[model samples]
Target chain A: MLARPAAEKGLNNYMNDMFAFDETDRKIVEQLRRNGRATNQQIAESLNLIASTVSTRIRRMEEAGMLRVVAVSDFAVHGYHILIHLAVQVSGRPALEVAEDLAVFPEVFAAHLVTGSYEISLLLTLRDIDELPPLITGTFAKVPGIKSMTPAVGLDIVRYALDTGPVDSRSAA
Target chain B: MSRPELDDLDRQLIGILAQDARVSNRKIASDLGVNEGTVRGRIKRLQQEKLIAFTALTGMKLEKAANIAFMAIQADTAHVRRIARDIADIPLVKAVMIMLGPFNVMATCLYHDLDDLHRLASGRILEVEGVTHVETSLVVKTVKISNRVVRITDADTLSQG
Candidate 1:
């Protein structure tokens, strides 16, 4: 039907808007990545642009929900020496609702509604290994809709960055 | 321990930065009723201790990610670390963690489609020397992605995100 092409065009437009940054914008983002605390004036000096322009571009990116400048706390900072990846299979309720419930826990850093073998996935930070039992049996057990879970404790953080990185293929082989 | 290693002032400063990393150092110093030197010193000490960092988080483009998978792999223990590092080099593999549970190695990846995911798993991951097995689960929706889901003890600050 004609409706399909129209819907496709709308989706394409939405995608285009999200990644509409030009060469200057990309360079600005690269500069931020190199040093997040760099001031707008510093960035403008390096990029050879106006300070206000750099500020405007960063603000625009933040407003569009595409980027943010935030403080990143190390796991050890809060006594969370253990990082856990849990695959959860949901039952008796919608996965999204359960995921939202899981997200409320301060220990959960990232919670996603997923498919294939599991219905949900969680990345949690824990202070100690001893806290695992109490968390699994006491706290998580009380939460409804969780059927089963398989947890993997991180032995080493090979790589972990919240940023998705640059849009270009430079990072690739 | 029941409490985190922070005093009230540290908690407040951290909370403010958690909300906005780029808040002027002067502003933070003024709000915290401390001098600019004190604020700068605290941040420097914290970074030296590897407690916190300031950075920009670029969100994954909605359209670019047609499939996101958490791939769990079993690798020989001796080479787990090396294998994990190798996997991290792969562009699509965003994160790699050497674990000590049901799976020995885990990777988070963003790909264009199921076929792309398949190619990475089969063509690339399977080719690794130490890898024994691989399992993947595709993400259907992102419930929450936040850098500030920290529980700052003693201050009673638990982020809603």
Candidate 2:
């Protein structure tokens, strides 16, 4: 328990120090979030900065593993119809192990080793609502050390954004 | 909803753009054995169809020393949708969904630390009118996070393979 948080803090400290992701980077990212195709000249013009600085910062952030501009596909518009959240209780095995094992499945979108009543939390995408039954009973039942699973099928997804925050002093809590 | 299938060239273009959305269309066109106009036109059509979006997705843990959490909520059955929307509007919440099963509503949120997560669950989410029970879980480790909802048609499926 003590070791993980300490390791996390140390790693985060290194990351924060390794890259100075400041106000300018945030502004730059905001612009890109709005339009990823925006030219460096355009971003520089909008932000009132030198085009070289815009280019330099973007290159720096991307190289340092601090940013990624990805082309994301829509979920519902394609064939995937159902999304479910599952709170899993584990016994006899480390939660991370199970979480990692579960991660390989294409349907498991996000798997987390968690702290609470349940040991692991999962987000799943499915072809149809009916997939839930066979998945829970037939598939998940086969995985070792899964004591029980409490699942909630998403009837309507109000929001599905994952790139949450680079929360700092200005945006903390 | 019926939609046109993405051809091999289309998927290949998308794959390159997926890696670097900022890549020049001219660069992509040359690599794909097509003209810059063709590349631009396809990207425009894909965007207009709402099939793809270009955005900067942040690495939260590295970016802000933030953590992720999920809140499972029990809400008034009649007003579940309303309550879910309310939770969605709150800060820190990345996603919210009205659900069916043991809990009626679920949310995924990011926090600077456990305190922020605790505050979000008890202070923000619970205070919503229709919420009854709110069970919060803090993510200790993130195994995977993805949103690969791409559709593969039979044409590209065989050709690409």
Candidate 3:
């Protein structure tokens, strides 16, 4: 009985350490979001802080595994026109193992282990629609735990961003 | 295509940027064995074309802490685009996609918790005109989230067809 409370306390502490970011850290993150290629000096100039301070904050964020600077290219521009969201159900083995397997494919952009109608979900970027069948039959067929795979071909993607945005009470009314 | 096509040099620049968006132009130019002017010109063109963007992506740690849901909706097919736009405007919606499979509209949203997800899914999502059905699945774990997943192949082949 004592172990359970101690475990809960530890978990809470862990989460607090993981997500804790002050105002300055958040500001630096916002600046980086605006221009990921911005140099430390440029960010410092824009934020009105020393370059070393900006660099240190960024380095701290990087070390904490909270952020990364990456190039986001339009899939259609690079010839991978078809974007399909896959809902996969796993049964025979551990879902995490199967998800890890799915992540190895180059076409897969995001893979998540979830609960509901499906056990795993994936965002697959195919060069063309023709590549879908081969991928479904050849690659996915070999995975041991997959029970079903449902594909939703993206016709139009309206918004894709990281910002969660503020809570809008209008929705509740 | 309305956008300008990428040439070999453009592809090379994009490929380099895709690896490390923060890499300096001088470094990229030296790595690609091209003049700085050429690299700068191609990067400017790519940015103007909206073909490539540099941004910070939230890692899986933050995603895991948040309540991420995959919400699929079936609305009147005619108003699917309009509904998509409305849903996109809703707070916490990370992505909204009009799909062509079992569901007409699919979205990924972040919520403060299960209660927050319940409010959005049961409230605004259901109240939307023409929306007939809604299915929401809470994400339990994120295995991978990457922006640079596409492999760069032959530039000519990628440019054509």
Candidate 4:
């Protein structure tokens, strides 16, 4: 149900025109979104399709870089005492470089370049609030082309989803 | 919530659906090289066994609802369970966990404003019988949130084993 026109014509054309997914492929993607480690046999059975077909489609999708299945944990239960989101505004270096560097930090779970006042937003986890000052002052602020940062600690997470939404299988039809 | 002993095939099926829940049985059957009927039957059994359950994700669109805070609570041993239950009943609380270390209970709460948050932290939370200390931090924004458990690629790779 979530649809956005690709920012570039080449990638968009390649995905939409060159690589059009069939209903079965979309369904396969859906199944994987629900459980990344789903076996091809299991996926095929769920969709009432041949297992070989499911396997082939999954292989194709993986090569395309459209999806990846990985493990994730809730930091709150894992002894992560301090959770915070940093809204960073950059002035000099390429935003992507800053984002890539931030992503490498073990405490950083995720980072993104977004529109509006901030150029990048980072999600971080730590063992205690005391650990935060050193992380920001020593690492984040030291990144070249640095500008300003607004840190918002996460008090609670109400809801979140990994997949944007169900694949529009109807599009294939 | 019945924990059924899943076979390899069952694990495969669960993995696929865990990533994409809307996949059709026909498509899934094709991919796994199994009969559609078998896929259907297995899914039915999985659901019946209570190994799998489904819930839609909601409230991603941010609203100007209230200020949110995270609080770590330490309580006397005898009063821990009772206090946990009481905090869970508070409607504004979104998530709570019983943790180890200095803080025994960790919780997330939402309020209409700072005053509401202050009232709960000072009045209700502090008033609890066995509470020794409370550390609170306010959340400004959320970058990512997810409940999906990561897939264990290799059992042999597990350190515990």
Among all candidates shown, the one with the greatest TM-score: 2
| Model 1 regions more than 4 Å off | A1-19, A164-173, B1-7, B62-67, B148-161
Interface RMSD of 1: 8.9
Error of 4 at A72 (Å): 3.7
- Model 4 lDDT tens row, A46-106: 8888776776555554444443343222232235556666667888788778777777777
Q: List the residue pairs that clash in candidate 1.
A: none
Q: i-RMS values of the candidates, in order? A: 8.9, 9.3, 10.5, 12.1
* lDDT (C-alpha) at residue A62 in model 4: 44
| CA lDDT, candidate 1, residue A24 | 71
lDDT for residue A57 in candidate 3, whole number 0-100: 65
Residue range B52-117, candidate 3, lDDT tens digits: 666665544444336678898998999899998788777777677899889999988877777778
The residue pairs in collision within model 3 are none
Candidate 1 vs candidate 2: the lDDT winner is 2
DockQ scores of all models, one per candidate: 0.38, 0.38, 0.36, 0.07
Q: Arrange candidates by DockQ, highest first: which order?
A: 2, 1, 3, 4
Model 2 Cα lDDT, one tens digit per residue, A47-133: 998787788777767765667776656663455677788888999988888888888887787788888888988989888778778
Candidate 3 ranges beyond 4 A from true positions:
A1-19, A162-173, B1-4, B60-65, B148-161
- Better-scoring candidate (TM-score), 1 or 4: 1
Cα lDDT computed for each candidate against the true fold: 0.71, 0.73, 0.70, 0.56
Scanning candidate 4 chain B in windows of ten residues, the lowest lDDT window is: B152-161
- Kindly report which residue stretches of model 2 are placed more than 4 angstroms away from their true locations once superposed: A1-17, A129-134, A164-173, B1-7, B147-161
State which candidate has the highest DockQ. 2
